[model samples]
Target: MFNGIVDVCWIPFAGFISFLIILSAINKSVGVRKAYVNILLRIFEYGRASIESASKENTQSVRENVTSDQNASVQPVKDVDANESTNGATLITRDAVLLPQAQESGNDKPQTLKKEEFNFDFENCLDYVKSGVEAIIEDDVTSRFEAEELKSWNMLTRTNRHYEFISWKITLIWMFGFAVRYSILMPLRVLVCFIGVVWLTVCTAAVGNLKDGNKKRAIVNNVLGQCFGVLSSAISAVITYHNEDNRPSSGICVANHTSPIDVLVLMCDTNYSLIGQRHGGFLGVLQRALARASPHIWFERGEAKDRLIVAERLKQHVSDPNNPPILIFPEGTCINNTSVMQFKKGSFEVGGVIYPVAIKYDPRFGDAFWNSSKYSMMQYLYMMMTSWAIVCDVWYLPPMYRQDGESAIDFANRVKGVIAKQGGLVDLVWDGQLKRMKPKKEWKEIQQVEFANRLKSD
Candidate 1:
């Protein structure tokens, strides 16, 4: 009975299934059928309107040409008659009799000129139409190109700075690289890491909450650190850590800002009390989960009072031996791994031992910079997963205390200098938030000069 049913319906069913799958894939990348239909309708309307406009212009030009031709022919005839009548009495020779005919022949020259002018106008109209059509076609092409580029996994992938133009062969190789990384390894790694993270976070939180002693909390912290180590290993194809022994056991740890993975890399080695802004969306979920596992200070950056509270909390966290060392990215925002932006003074003002950690990545593997404004969390993760590998170098410098009379701003800059030096990154004086809103051209040069002058004076 089953065999008979399969023979009767299998072919059609298979075709229908294939059609549905294709439609689903298209919808996933380019939105639903209705959106595409609307886009097609818009294109059709624009083309029709352009055609109508061109036709109207052509018709108007034709009518003008016909009117001009009649005028040219009639005016020449009238001029010939007038000249012949005016000169009739004065002219008696054969040459004189043929003068009107000669004048009429000369009038043909003006008619020829009028016809040439009409032809020129018609050509101009045709050129106008051609330009309009070309513009429309270019716009369509550009929109389609952008749509396809967005569909690709490498939307925010940075171009290699060393090489501007890449060959087709190289492009094909990268395409294959993306296919293998995203299609196969990425999903498996995500599933395994996510499960490990959830289990570890929940257990750590439960144990820390239920147990009353500092020893148990410390143990949980170690386990959480190990979990991150496993995660980093799972996601990164190749990772190398330097000066791991230099990591501070306690007090404040400040690092240069780069990717979201910077925190993961730091956590993999050290048990630190994180101090950062309270984030929303999927990031907020991770923040909340980690906050449960440990006493991480998540503050609302928009609230002035909250900022003050965060400073006090940092001070308190660092002073407590039972708590993990406090970790903060003093830059407050991620810059392109090319430079270290000015550090915020809040973390530095806590007035304690500061451990500066420098982080740098080899772009030959993959870029670790998180372009948050351009990409969502999932998109960023996909980019990371699809790359060849994420390779990083971590440098831990000696701890520094505030100089006897040094201000918070000066202290922050000094720390930023150390990190930037160790990481082999350019030191920038512009505030990250300001740079984001205005742009580099507006303030970068002026700020750099001012920073240089300040440095020279000091």
Candidate 2:
């Protein structure tokens, strides 16, 4: 009976999946995903209310059991006058305050110089101690590298706040969610992703052989973007793109780096020539496939000469009116989606219209930040695949030009500020590479010099 059920249903199941893939590849939705998302939102609301109610109940019970047993101890007061009388002594105090001396009425000679003095105060060190402690507890740079904390539980085990066992209803709901995500959603998503990748490879390979022309470029862009859209659906990505009118036609496009999928997310909407270090494995396959039909710059991982080559290639690509805009993450590293870190000045120095794009991911659905230090590319992809969904907002800001007197660093910062503001992300001046590197000696020296000046002023 089981074999018969599987045999009868498998073919239809495969056919249905194939149909969904076609719809995704064509960038068409039947509102099924929208409806599914709505259902999930309702469930999330119910779970949030349940968790809050359970939390209140637990707090009340805890308070009831928490007895106010803090004992108060008092000591008898002694009379200062009585003690003074007993000792037969009178206390005399003198005012230690110093007043500025008045200038002599008619003296031509300058008053004797008073030597300046410096006294070390232990209290002055307390501020540094407090700052150190605060940094240890929660520093800006370190916190930006970690997973963002959610206000409420999202019903995922990875983000567990022990809310599942708070009540029987919540526990049951969690179990159901677990089964749905792992047993149903994950397998289906994997199958869809596999099909999308295979389709991209075959499609790009055929298109690569065609002569490079306007029609060929147009077809390649559509095919590549649509293929990415299909892959995005594998993770149930619900992307809301804003200000599409400002989308880049050509030149340099900059954005905050979060996850590898940031590329996929943006590419789903439009094609761009990607820039990054070449890799092996799953990413390598995708890179090779993309390079077949598009103009992407993938350099060796640790090549010293790659920078000059990349810069030259960048200039040549942007100079051409025919090529797609070069998409560059000027941050040079992935930062947790909570903040936008320092933008490298290299891309800004290239001298072209800077198209700033902002991407903000909804952590309640899933964490989109890829902590490369903690997880490998494959490991991160697995987490994304198992996640509930990838929901993000992309904003395309108006093209900005470098001011006449603006240096590349200032130009980069100006662009970074715009992206951060649009994305509702913290604007940080710290380099994102600080995640793996120690603080620069110059940075520490600057702080030290500031501290010395502060001490002198005090």
Candidate 3:
């Protein structure tokens, strides 16, 4: 599996192999291939220099802050100016004495404007060092890449036939590989599931926790779920009806989270209660709006009583024939589509059909960390923008019936194993014994017959 993987992944690796074969055929040395990697090396150098510069700037800022703190009681060293504060100048500390607002009646100290402190003095020093050391050591890489692209595109647009023949062949290599690998081969089937994440976080449809008891946006909610799933997936998502008329009746829906987009994928047009974290500041307002529109909510998993109240409310949604299924994440925690995590036991408690869905991210944002990590949302956004390879896989298992004695934990485990198997996270890919989930019913029924025969003999 890994062998087939390396061959299909990334242009540089594929290009290297092609170059080597041609050289070997003509008995030429492989050293000429080194010229192609200069761009990559230059990029690495630029990234390293940027990081080093940022660290030095931060260290200097911190030292200045600490020094100011030590002399907090001393006389004001410099006149305060608004714009200077943002550029590593002295700042208003919490302990500083504040003058009353100018809006207050009878206050008349006029504001004074100070001469600008030139940024060029500091910037020139950095640039001089960069040009003398960094630039000399490395080509002006960013500009070089831009220039190269311009040259390549300019060459491609030329009408000359000889150049056109070679250009067409070169273009085909990159496009054909990207199309077949990302579209036809692996094709980011799971990336289709990214919409569910967005739904939970950023859809305008949410409106926030419902106050109207029921204002009627069920169909719209469900439609958005399917639409976002389709839009986010790149391949349009189709919502198949579970009941006779291609309409999904009451059931429990479970999914994985990779990004805020998942929310849009899961809740679009569905007349059901969507649940989310209770405490994210503005979420309270949004939840209130959704509450007014429908009965969706803000849930704090840590609060047992609040959750029980929410769970009871969920039962009402499931009981209502007009409302759609309760969509949920069986795994309470988010996970990178790596190894499947243990499923949370919330949905099976709702009873009725348990819709088991296996969510896997695709190439685009598939490696997205779902587990708890210290990374900021801003950082995740930065990576998502530059990398541009996130895909999600959603495999919906047939709705299951919950038996009277069966616990939610058992049902969740069964679903988790099926999802794990279907998503290809475990087994032949990882070279480990796959943890077995519940066996297929057909296999179980056949196995039971043999077990009964053995018991009869005993």
Candidate 4:
């Protein structure tokens, strides 16, 4: 009797439980469907933003801005072919990228010139102007470096010039300083090492601390750049420097990046911080450690992070009165020091008193330039001992503040032009002492060289 009673009541109760489970399942499915729809909406919004940014890349917009420069005189393009223009049958001087016209020969152009001889307005305007940079020394204008001023040695002289790094006088001074800091004096070697460890730790944090998302742990990496310049100075008697108004506060700083010493050289002037990068191995770990202790920032390259965060952080630091100006090598990579490399964009973005620096090495230690490519820390140090001194010029451009609607590329071009004039590297910076680098032609040259080299025999 008890079993029969239990079966009758439990069956109805079990039906109610089953009904509740089905209802809950239906609710979850609806919730998931709504969440997916929300995701799609967000994706659609991002696509809209992408389309808007792409619109800015159109040439029509750039041409419009190009047309409005009122200060320039109108120069007519002589003998331009009508077929190459958008107006079809009419030559559009502005539409064609500016190139120097072939000079007229005695045999050409028999007709006498009339003021309206050509119908087209000649935009003698250049798409990219390559001139040596003008050097500034704190409003105490020293002269500008002319491209003609730089006379190249089919090679720079590196004769039997011997160098003595540690003079007996300096040696004694170092000994005294070392003696004062000896472990015997304070037993602080362990503590100093620990401090280094802590400094490294802080360096790692600093890498990511100020970066906008795309930045690598680059602070330590940048600070380390100073080592190369210093090494160059160690070998050569040329000591080059330029002042930069890095932050908007007091001023900015810019210098020629001849070696790792590029950063060190700037540090000599002010206690500025660096932007660096982080690696994945032991070296990276070591760099990360350095970042943790220092006021450096490390960011991984290609990391999908918002760089605006880092930019804002730096902006705040620069705004503060206590911080020194920010310093950066506009030429992102180290060069052979004969000429300047193409300026990268970030250095131009920070709004402040803008200064352009032109750095060159003296013929002191060209081999140090060699070690710049293949040497590790130990190798670099060894190379430094054997060779590496520099003769360099530091040219500072006038300070600048960010204008409305400026792009990094434009700033790079402008600043590059300034530095080229200042440093006398127009010929050397791009292809070395032959012809100046054309702004648009530079990429084309690389492409052409690659294409031509691809078919070469082994």
Best model per lDDT: 2
Q: After the best TM-score superposition of candidate 2, give how far the Cα of residue 225 lies from its true spot, in angstroms.
A: 1.8
| Candidate 3 per-residue C-alpha lDDT over 118-197 given as tens digits, one digit per residue, 9 for 90 to 100 | 23334324433444464344422212111111111111121112322233443454355336444542333333223333
Cα deviation at 252, candidate 1, in Å, is 0.7
Error of 4 at 70 (Å): 68
- Backbone clash count, each prediction separately: 0, 0, 65, 87
Please provide TM-scores, in order, for all candidate models, with all chains considered together: 0.59, 0.86, 0.42, 0.41
Residue range with the least summed lDDT across 10 consecutive positions in model 4: 139-148
Query: lDDT, candidate 1, residue 320?
Result: 83
| Regions of candidate 3 where Cα sits further than 4 Å from its true position | 1-219, 222-249, 257-260, 267-272, 281-292, 300-307, 364-366, 427-458
- Candidates 3 and 4 compared: the better one by TM-score is 3
Best by TM-score: 2
| Residues 136-190, model 2: lDDT tens digits | 6556577788787765577887877587887898899889988988898999998
The lDDT for every candidate, in the order shown, is 0.60, 0.81, 0.44, 0.42
- List candidate 4 segments past 4 Å from native: 1-252, 279-294, 302-313, 367-373, 404-406, 427-458
